[model samples]
Target: MTATTADSVLTARAVLLDMDGTLVNSDAVVERCWRRWADRHGLDFDEVIKVVHGRQGYASMAVLLPERPMAENYAENREMLAAETADMEGVVPIPGAPAFMAALAGLRLPHALVTSADVPLSTGRMAAAGLGLPDVRVTAESVGASKPDPEGFLKGAAELGFDPADCLVFEDSEAGILAGRAAGMRVVGVGARAAALGPTVHVDDLTGVRIADAGGGEFRLTFG
Candidate 1:
């Protein structure tokens, strides 16, 4: 549901953020990469794009090519990662992402990045977006399963020394929202598509989101 003024003050001990569509604006690169992959594999680009967001490359590949061996999926994922890192053509920070991160730092609140991208790809995209890396990051290699499984978000909360219930997750895709919910955290959808996923709170973007000192290791999220 969309955030109302009455629901703006959300209290949490930590924040969990998704990297791609949530923070880094890599839509162009992501679509380009996936489209090329789909074309080469004889899959419908439109259909492939639908399930690729908020999922690990390997996981998405497995869905697209269910009959492929695990080893082949891994190999293809590595190649995709390399391609993504090498091409930073349209990467940039999403609106309000910089300010939201700044608020997190300013409040001295704990936060972790939970992403489906592996280390190299995540780092490259973040760098291209001009976003600083968080203290704790949960990438594809860090968890046994990707989003829609809750493993990554659970891992992120654990690494941040916070209970899942005490963390607020910010996500931009349906899979991520489901994962956050499964992790027992309140989720704030960060985009229109995410909003459609029925997160606890939804915002068009991070533009007016701010952190307020709530004292005693807790902070209030002021959603604009």
Candidate 2:
């Protein structure tokens, strides 16, 4: 991984993006749901929130409740997914996300959404955020393991027909950044949460980014 600097240029043949904190600001809903879960289990929401981002609900549960049975986590995760999908309150796109997506469309770069969110949850959240879904997606159901395992990002790169080294990832959470690195892709950390995670580059938001076609199946990302 490269140092996290505001000014940098990265070239890649494909792009993989994380949702939630990266493209969408769903923290309000995330905190609300996780707070309830934390309370129910007599855990601290503060610590739980730190582990919840960039991972599937069951994965987060496993980390928070290491001694709990996997079966129990899976069951609760299902319920949590349904509840989160049904609730769209406070879901909104990150600043400049709309323009960023539009820019990608204009450039026609190969890109995919590689998110820990299941199909329904991802779909609902993106809709609530008013962002168009990328044609290729690697959702929670698409892989056996979650973020920090590199499964989803690797799958996304494969589906896009690009090698991991040829892809660039945009992520916000520590788990997502680690997964991108594990997949051998350069990462552009998206928010304040991502600053200390050692992404190839860090930006305050999409507003600080500029994407341009660099010809020959490659795209250039300029961060400021």
Candidate 3:
């Protein structure tokens, strides 16, 4: 949780990215769907949204409806995923996401998408945001536990053929920042929500991050 200065530089062999609030700004669609869910469940929409950002649908439901059956949560999660995937009206990339992704691709960097979104939902949302998918992806279906558990980031690092300590995670939620740390990786917190959470570095958006080859299969991430 070392905060960054304009001169800060982090070197890593691989990068792991979170989707929703990190790379894609899908808050509009998330609000629409979750608000409806909250109404149906007779819960507070404000409270529900607070817990929904970094978790999978079932995980979020379980938090909001602790007494609800796990079977019911899974069932409803399927429906929620469908609704989110089908509605991409307000989905857009976070600032500098397009260029950041392009820079990674152009540099042939080792990177993976580690998101709470399942395959279809991730695909649709990234498409809507006009962003390219990384070759390695650890989606909801790929992990048994959600963020704050560290499984996704660990798997992402393994798939990228790097040790967790050699990888850097870019995320925008408390759950995500915790997960990255638990995985023994450095994390770059993105967006306003992440500013309050302690990450290895904090940035308003991807625009504040500049990555350049550091030689020997590593890259240097300069942050402000």
TM-score of each: 0.95, 0.96, 0.97
lDDT of 1 by residue, 147-210 (tens): 8999999999889888889999999998899999999999988987787788777888889787
> With candidate 1 superimposed using the best TM-score fit, by how many Å does residue 86's alpha carbon deviate from the native?
0.7
Off by over 4 Å in 1: 1-5
User: Which tens-of-lDDT digit does each residue in 1-224 have in candidate 2?
Assistant: 13334458888888999999999999999999999999999998999999999999999999999999999999999999998998999999999999999998889988999999999999999999999999999999999998899999999999999999999999999999999999999898999999998788888999978888878887878888
- By summed lDDT, which 10 consecutive residues of candidate 2 come out lowest? 1-10
**Least accurate stretch of 10 residues (summed lDDT) in model 1?**
1-10
Stretches off by above 4 angstroms in model 2 are: 1-7
Error of 2 at 152 (Å): 0.4
lDDT of 3 at 220: 83
Q: lDDT at 114 for candidate 3?
A: 99
lDDT of 3 at 53: 91
